[model samples]
Target: MTTLHLEHASHAHIHGPACGHTQVPHGDHVDYAHDGHLHREHGGHWDECEPDGHAPHEGHDHRHGEGCGHESVLHGDHVDYLHDGHRHAPHDGHWDDH
Candidate 1:
């Protein structure tokens, strides 16, 4: 068991979901940044969701920025995380594209 904290590390949208991309869904622990919130792996699966409707995590109000290239901007409940200079969204199993 590992306890990881949030950091300003950028995650390319390409490293995100595979609904329409080549990247596969996360099987191991994968931390995600969306809408100023962090959804990490807790308990047994990636059940630590942080959608806008869900309660916000304390002291979690910072974006990971564009370290992986392209910019990430907040877009309503989901985030328009960019990759390859194009806007892309991560696949949170609980929600679809909005």
Candidate 2:
């Protein structure tokens, strides 16, 4: 299991999987240039991007288990939710184009 060290303004050294990268949901329009570091906001949370020393993967899947249901964010693809053996696509409100 590879770990990623995220350097942020108020905090640093957040360890997680290499391929499991998540951007804090902050409305829309992500700004990468802040404090001379890669920054991402999601759900009102901010995190620093992986530096050049980190390895980049072609695909990234960040999923978490919540009770009997599961939530996931798939890169380069659509978001999906699996609950009780049934799969559901994200609602129209989840995307801006809709």
Cα lDDT over the full model 2: 0.36
Per-candidate TM vs. native? 0.24, 0.25
Pairs that clash in candidate 1:
none
Per-residue lDDT of model 2, residues 1-98, tens digit only: 12134535564434233423432232343323233333554444556543233232222233333452454433235543433332233433331211
Give me the overall lDDT of model 1: 0.39
lDDT per model vs. reference: 0.39, 0.36
Q: What is the lDDT, from 0 to 100, of the residue 18 in candidate 1?
A: 45
Q: Kindly give the stretch of ten consecutive residues in candidate 2 with the minimal lDDT sum.
A: 89-98
Q: Write the per-residue lDDT of candidate 1 for residues 21-81, one digit (tens) a residue.
A: 3221223434454445445544433332322333222332234345745455565465655
